[model samples]
Target: MVFRRGSSQSWPGLGGGSGYTASLGMLRAAVLLVSLPWGAQGAACANVSMALGHRGPLPGGRYLSIGDGSVVEFEFPEKSEGIIVISSQYPGQSNGSGANPMLRVTSLDTEVLTIKNVSAITWGNRGGFVVSIHSGLPGQAPLHIQLMDPHETPPVLIEERRDFCIKVLPAEEAPATRGADQVHFSENPILYLLLPLIFVNKCSFGCKVELEVLKGLLQRPQPMLLGLLGQFLVMPFYAFLMAKVFMLPKVLALGLIITCSSPGGGGSYLFSLLLGGDVTLAISMTFISTVAATCLLPLSSAVYSHLLSIHETLHVPISKILGSLLFVAIPIAAGVLIKSKLPKLSQLLLQVIKPFSFVLLLGGLFLAYRMGVFILADVRLPIVLVGLTVPLVGLLVGYCLAICLKLPVAQRRTVSIEVGVQNSLLALAMLQLSLRRLQADYASQAPFIVALSGTSEMLALVIGHFIYSSLCPVP
Candidate 1:
């Protein structure tokens, strides 16, 4: 993954940018929304939350200020997802309501959700409410949300809307969210310099690969069927299903799609070694999946297009594909030459590098976390659950497939590991590159959350296997 410098304005409400939200008015309101943390629509003031020693409970979200009573109307296309936060007082205030606030959200004269007098559920702002929504069909005009007094006459307080207003934008124009503020990403120099090491660490493991084990793959290709089916068919669909079930934002859902569609991670061999699986099979599967990814990745992505709820096709980066091939080939080739020329050195290198791969894997994770701390923190529970389950299910399916084929125990373990640990690095790389070409900020977040969860789950599997191996007595 590549990293670069970034700059951003801090959002007003929520702390971390976790999921997605409709961004129809995001860019415009960010300027004033954060500042006016309290008051009715069309009102303005300074940011009061900054003085609370930064230990703020305010979930990051767009904030709007209204004078006494006013209505804020949002005009956008269909399939939008977002959050509308109505704060009765400044975010920093720990007690009571900010002048008894009330709001009624509507779309096309129909009330979709309501925010009345804040209850204890509103935390400190006892009279405020934070609500999320998914918009309806595509219409020529916009949908409207009104803020009014519970004791008012027409229920429509003011005829005007202001800069700090919150509106749910269309899905494509907005992001799917889990009731959190939009994340602010600022680049880290440490991330940029160390990110490429992830690929190098992965390739180092490939250096120990054996060409003889690959010959079996060439001769009997039946075992390859399970890996192919699981990568192409089962995983991607599972991610889609999880996204839908959880009502996840569009971008995060798509991120899960890309990750599930990806091939086995480069760490498959290490996992196989840790679990006493067939290292040869692990390496072969990783290589084959990486090679086939050029065609299947896009195809898998297209297969779920209708469900994506997106109008534009994401551009696949050719350079990332070629880079995957190059990284895989060069290190293995060097390792092969080293083994052929100096057998003793090869043994020593393997002993040193085998465990080193795991260390580098987590080190890269640290780099990634430092690079996009808020993005990782912004990941919601649904995405996390799906990410963990996808690989675990892949492992079980792979093991079942291997058993049906009458494969040996070693091969079974290898296939299981290979199927479970997808090449999250490549998926992340593609997501970072593809998202730059798209208009949605949440899209970038989707893949990232999947990557984080996927990687963590794989590590958990490895550790669980280690504990199991230690407890079981050898024959």
Candidate 2:
């Protein structure tokens, strides 16, 4: 049974499905190329009667031909903003019953991306988009592409509307198609739920501080620098090297780098207390790392993405990182500022921040784990090895670095745990915000693996510390 406008071919539906009773518009150059964010609406033009064929349509296979339910390949025209206009017939020749054709746009790359385009962004000359559409019911689709505050999705307009008799030529499976547009939100549908959980987790972080704790940091800039070394230098460098040594895939390697580059965990101070380490140093490391990550996150990402060849252009999520920094810094800063200005209020807030943070941390972890189960399923074994070993190595190298510098034993333990227990929550949040939702889910494979590993390994270390304390009775 072929799909109709309100058909039973049920795709894993993504929200907006309303359309207008539109006029016929031209394909290609006639439609306006405006830039807009995802979910932002625009108009469509339904004017042109484009005869989209494999080769016959627009001189040299430039327009997509919907040739009678087969695979059609089209070359994206130069000077176009990632938009490929196709038409079946004129408006008067449309099947007014409104049973629109269905099409799937797959990129030339290995991954199967469900390409959904709102509009495109163009440079003076940047041509790298190659894709194919599997469209049914061939001829010209007389869709009038117009600018609407509320427009039907751009990608499927020519094919979906029933009015045009499309002339699309279907292509067989090509190995490497072109790349453009945001990927489908197919894999991790639960990512929508995970995002808000991330926000709440960050909000609770405000309570994790005191003015006295922050002021103590200036006294030992040396130790703080060591912590930074353990964080920025040892952890990220180690993750990248490990990925190379293990021969991990590009995306997976990026994930590992992200996790290792992340700041000390919000839970670092608690972990230090359990391990008989310096809690104040742990708190200070968390503060500095979180605040400083505004720069480090993007910088480190640029370095690793280039080395790994993840993308050609720099699409780092600048605003998202800034938002994250604000969330982390403001809460801690407010708590510290309030402590000096109003000690009683400060004390009460910390008291609340400490306990609820743990509870929220647990709940958030559970939700994140549910969302990430699919990602972990796709991960191969070498990445698992990287995640498991990297944090443990951080613990070893951090302790060793501190010992070499002759920091007190307590500070050494604190540095070790701080370095070892990555702020995976921050990493996860960054993964979601910095990249497109689909990109985030794919890239998060290594970080989530590291996170799960961190959870288990940290538990083991804490248990060992308790046993050691019972036996040796540290005086």
Candidate 3:
């Protein structure tokens, strides 16, 4: 039952040859000498054809015309099973009495498709085989079929077919008839619970935004413009480049691109505050970038998805975008009003806002860890490596761009943190809303990993900055 690749050993006992090698020349010569046509050799086993279940033969015989190149493809839905019937016109010739040729089928990519059972049929000198194929993940792999002479000490491949391929398509999803305003949170219960808390944290941070600082930035808008350019322009391109450089799969690449295309995360202002950056600029940039995402997110996603050859109609959740904006805007407006009207209450909220944000951060990390254990269980090393590098690249690009524009040091730090920390939750929501369950869950790994990486890296930088400041007090 052992199959060897590139073995030049002869296939003995064919065409009256005592020890005939199964080389192309010898096989062709035997066909000519025995008056057996190439298609009829191996008792017509060479003229192979396949079909799904009991259906008619596929269009190109053994060479299916389903996809390009030498491979012919047949697709099976994920987590489903199907029968592939492989038949030849004539029965395989027996080496001796009551001996039938052995049929072996193997799936080259077992992760995508599994060959459960291979059943052979031989009656009245007519032979064929049926293969039961089970689908796994959404992917494609070559299926190898071998008609071997079992009479030999070791099975010798009589007629081999490698052109047939199996593709596991993503499971079909029922059309979503839900209205734009309606939201579904059926994917992950933990994430569903955490969403409200996350938005609440964002609202709390909005309370800390200083209106005077925002007014000054509006008067001189270079820092704000620079932050937008880094957040929307540079980060998406960096993500696309990284996806290509790492040769990530289409779904993973799309996930990374979507995450990068998103706006600044809710935590950016906190990071800026802790790291001696301009907190007002951080909050302003976050708000502006989020509003910009209404148009820019879909544009960037479309460009990159087209490049990745993904044809799925990815619908950007406009309601979600508008909701995010409302969450940010209303809270900030209320806070500004409170600051102007209830000065004492505003002062109290500002004093406790930093500690409240820290608590929310710890809660988010705990929730992310719980979800990461599920989403990232099978995450590959390349993706983890790429995810780790993405935020760092954004930080470097934003910092360099700020320096080029001659922004103040505090503004540079604010821009860097804003650009580097993406709103991965928005990306996650988009994916979950747009794609099927399995695909959405699978692609979600990118955002989750990126979120964890950015948080950890920014925290490390904040700690380092704190230590340096403590050691060398600035008088």
Candidate 4:
């Protein structure tokens, strides 16, 4: 009896035309005779072996490490396209005839690596086949190889399958020293010219901050505690949750987490001043959070990276954090000194501080927009959606927490602004310092989007508040 592929007919002897009962009896006797000997010798069948190029048999329970975008070949000493050759010799008998076993290769995760371009090749008298594997992102994926009985109707499994893991490592930057020098800047020279002016504006804003209000905050530290909790704890977890929910790519997710883990931005106090919130509380929270971030940022990133199954060494910019601290603290301290000692000079700074802040804000937005045009050219919708929503969500979370803690309305607004805004530049610095060029560029989108989103949203809120205040006079 013979069975052919794509034929709708059963084996000739097993057909149901006539004499089916007699044929069935004969088949049962034949199976009974063949089953006993087949089961006993099945264990002795020679299993096919596979090896990565020159690596020798994939090291039994070890993964092959390949850099992203690199190609690796798997070699098998059997000339079967989708088949494996197996030989079983009986006792006191010559070598058995080669059995053509079907071979199947599959990647557990195509995003990490892929198997393709399977072709046969000559390996002396015994022919062979090679499989080309292409690595994608930095992650681990299992490659499954199976041998099956090609003669079977549905191709039954011949024996246990072979599993090999491929670990794709991140592409390493060739010129490590030059990587630090590859700093990106806006094309417009005006942006560069405005940098010092922005710092001057920050100093001016510092002069306007009431020393008494800042002193009052130090005495009552509840708002500071709430801001820290929201900034470090709630924000990092929220970023992680959003990443998981939206299924962001690993690098992008890491970027988002790092951005969320950053300290409250310098812009928070500016927003507070614009919206009639507690500027002292905002400034104090920003400074305190920046200081606390030295420890808490690394902790938060480590915990969440582990959750995301990312094992790369994340570079946290401790120096950058300290520099930001100094940049903020020194200016504010100098301004406070001027305010206490030279009241006339302090009044001059206070008069121009608002205009300076407005000008700085416009300059920042212009620069950010220019940078975003380049960074977010290929940005995904999920990232944009997340970017738009994260600031709003953080604001709501902080406000609700403040309300629950029975804080004053001004302090609540301050906490909300502090929590919503993040130091995206710090996050960008970390990513650029840690990852390779391609990866750094790709990951940086999260920070850029978040920064732009937070700034734009806060500005809109400030304008709305201004309009409302103008319309409804305070009694």
Report every candidate's CA lDDT: 0.56, 0.54, 0.69, 0.67
What is residue 406's positional error in candidate 1, in angstroms? Answer: 1.9
Count backbone overlaps in model 4. 2
Model 2 lowest lDDT segment of ten: 121-130
**Regions of model 3 farther than 4 Å from truth:** 1-74, 79-136, 139-208
Q: Score candidate 4 by TM-score against the native.
A: 0.73
> How would the candidate models be sorted by lDDT, starting from the highest?
3, 4, 1, 2
Per-model TM against the reference: 0.61, 0.53, 0.68, 0.73
Those runs of model 1 whose alpha carbons end farther than 4 Å from true positions after fitting are 1-207, 436-441, 471-475
Segments of candidate 2 deviating more than 4 angstroms: 1-216, 312-365, 433-438
Give candidate 3's whole-model lDDT: 0.69
> Model 3 — which ten-residue stretch has the worst lDDT?
8-17
lDDT of 3 by residue, 1-475 (tens): 2222221122222221123322432343333324432222232222223221223333444322211222356656676655554554323332235455656677776656777665543323333454555667677767777777676878776667777887677765553753332223334476667666656555555566777788898999888788788877888888889888887767888898899898768788888888888877987888888888888888889988899777667888789788877877777677777777888877787787767766767777666766566567789988899899978988888899899989899999988888889898899888988776777878888998999998888878877988999999899
lDDT of 2: 0.54
Give the Cα-based TM-score of candidate 2 against the true structure: 0.53
